[model samples]
Target: MSVDEVAALSLTEVAHKIAAKELSAVEVTEASLQRIERHNEALNCIANVNAEDALAQAQKADERLAKGGPVGPLHGVPLAHKDMYYRAGRVSACGSKIRADYVPDITSTALKKLDAAGALEVARLQMVEFATGPTGHNEMAGTPRNPWNTDHITGGSSSGSGSAVAGRMVYGALGSDTGGSIRIPAYCNGLVGMKATYGRVSRYGAMPLSFSLDHVGPLCRTVRDCAVFTQVIAGNDPDDPTTSREPVGDYLADIEGGVSGLRLGVPTNHFFDDVDDEVREAIQESISIYEKLGAEIVEVEVPGIKHGFALGEVLGRVEAATYHSTWLRERPEDYGTQTRNRLMQGFYYPGTRYIEALNLRGQLLSGFTDEVFSVADILIAPSVPMAVPTIADTDISANQGFLDMIARFGSCTRPFNFLGLPALGVPCGFTGNGLPTGYQIVGRSFDEATLFRAARAFERETGCTENAPVL
Candidate 1:
């Protein structure tokens, strides 16, 4: 296949070609490297490119293929990691200047899983500083521009993961979600982003902004591609005691099951309020499509939805402050403006408030399960309240515009993290302004397969998965 053809192929298709001996692993790796070189300057997506290591790994994969050796499911696939994920010898800056020179001695469990699955890590993508903010703005490393529009923000934390995947620089990439890091960018850049149940995917070696809310998942071009990546990475790990002992389900099996007879809950109050008219319309249209596919739409109230965000904010801030306390005290100037301001605010949160927030989580979770799931199998809402905004439009000075933007964009997503549910952002339709709008499909705890099935069904019915940014 030509470089263009190879770059455009999905992860599943690439794996098939490699397994069939129709495409060499080196060919795909080289194509991805070349594409990164051509576009990274303009997009500023890739923070670190490991071309030599990737080629070496690719060569080994090709040798294994020639020997007819048993290979992992994703053999010879080229992929990237979010810069925040540690890779042993590589520096994990976490988009902060403080850690720009700090290198870890262990690789992230997520990266290890991808590597074991026969994926070559070609590069590390840029992200928001300390994964704190939602917009892709980074004063130290530079912002990752959206592939759809050079002027628009790429969304945050998982910023480069979304941009690179959407721009076809790599087949897929791993991203961490604290609030909405994964889903926001996924929606803004026209890709699929899954925030697995908090403990479903191990967080070992990935920089943590909030211990209770952090989740690692894949951002890819299609739902099946995300599933393929997730299947390789989701499971118990000895290193991460938080990882559940429950067996990982067959994510790809029966994924084409139509949404017929599935109960999809639409939260009428918190999720719909303050959403853009275009995004609201797109989400309604997506629900209608699912209903036409034999799914039942029920209006259900997600009890404590607003309170979930507030509690998440409290816990996230406290945990983040705990992690960065030493550095924050000693090297305060090394941090970026947005990250510093956000982390500092944790100092103001009283001990009683933090404990109260933690205590409230259980009650909120119980209410959500009892009230919401009683009526619906999965909850659906808009991923972001508004379309992708221009980088110039946001004030990164921790001003009113910046705070308001974060609250609005993250309003629909933060609640899920607090509830510890699996949530996915899938491209459903485009706004009248030509930007992509995503619908969030959330499932019960550890029920990512159900969410994936619903997302895949909607994607197939709408035929929007194939749409890419004009860039």
Candidate 2:
């Protein structure tokens, strides 16, 4: 296959080629590295590239193939990790000045799983300051440009992962989602980003944003590719007590199944309100496609979604402040204006308010389970209320617009984090200007298999997965 064809192949297809000896792991790794070299300067998607290490690993993968040794599912596939994820001896800035030079002694649980599956991490992708913001504009590390439109923002804090995956710099990358960080960028950049059920994937060694809300997942060009990545990462971890003991289902095995007879709940109240005209049209179009695919779409009511967002905000800020309290006091000036100001606001949350938010969260989750699942198998809605704003438009350097953007993006995504549900953001359509729009498919807790299958079916019908940004 040509380089473009090879680069465009899904992770599963690449693995199949490698197993058949039709393609060498070294060749796949080299192609990804070349793509990075060609696009990284303009996009700023990759913060660190470890070409030498990746190639060495690829060579070993080739040796294993030559010996006919057993290899894992993702064997010989090239991948990247968000800069926030810990890789021993590698600087994990977490998009902050305080920890800019900090390197952890241990690798993150997600990275360990990727490594076990034979995924070679070719680079470290850029992210928001401590995974705090939605826009990809990181003042400390230069903003990661959206590959679709260099002028538009790549949603963050998983900015680089979205940009790189959309730009086809690597087959897939790990991204952490606290509040739509993964899905927002995935939507804006035209990629499939999956935030597995909280604790479905371990967060050990990942730079913590909010311990309760943090989830590590994959951003890829296709829904099935996200499923493949999740299969390798999802499971119980001794290092993380929050991880679920439930078995990780066979995600890829169910991708070809259509969503026929599946009841999909459409929440037209909070999520559909305040969306851009283009985004609204795209979501309606996506719903039509789902209807055509034999899926039942019913309008469902979520009574406490707004309240759930409020609770998540209180908990996230309080927890985030607790983590950064010492740094905020000692080196407040080191943080960006947006980061410092937000962290400072967290300090003002009363002890009673934090406890109340936690209690409210439990009530909201129980209500969500009874209310949302009562009429449908999964809840579907637009991932973001609007298309990506211009980097110049969203004042990431300012305190107000930064906070406003975070609140707006999190309004739709944070509730799921609180409910501990599995949500997948799949590219639905493009806006008039050609920027991508995504629709989120949220499944019951630990039911990522259903979400992935539904997303893949939608992807097939819409042909959005085949679209990539030109670099």
Q: Against the true structure, what is each candidate's TM-score? A: 0.99, 0.98
Off by over 4 Å in 2: none
Model 2 residue 2 lDDT score: 66
lDDT tens readout by residue for model 2, 221-318: 88888898989999999999999899988998878899999999998689988888989898888888989999999999987998888888888889
lDDT of 1 by residue, 259-375 (tens): 889999998788998988888888888989999999999999778889999999999889999999999999999988887888887888999999999899989999999998888
What TM-score does structure 2 among the candidates reach? 0.98
Best prediction by lDDT: 1
Q: Give the lowest summed-lDDT range of ten residues in model 2.
A: 394-403
The whole-model C-alpha lDDT of candidate 2 against the native structure comes to 0.87
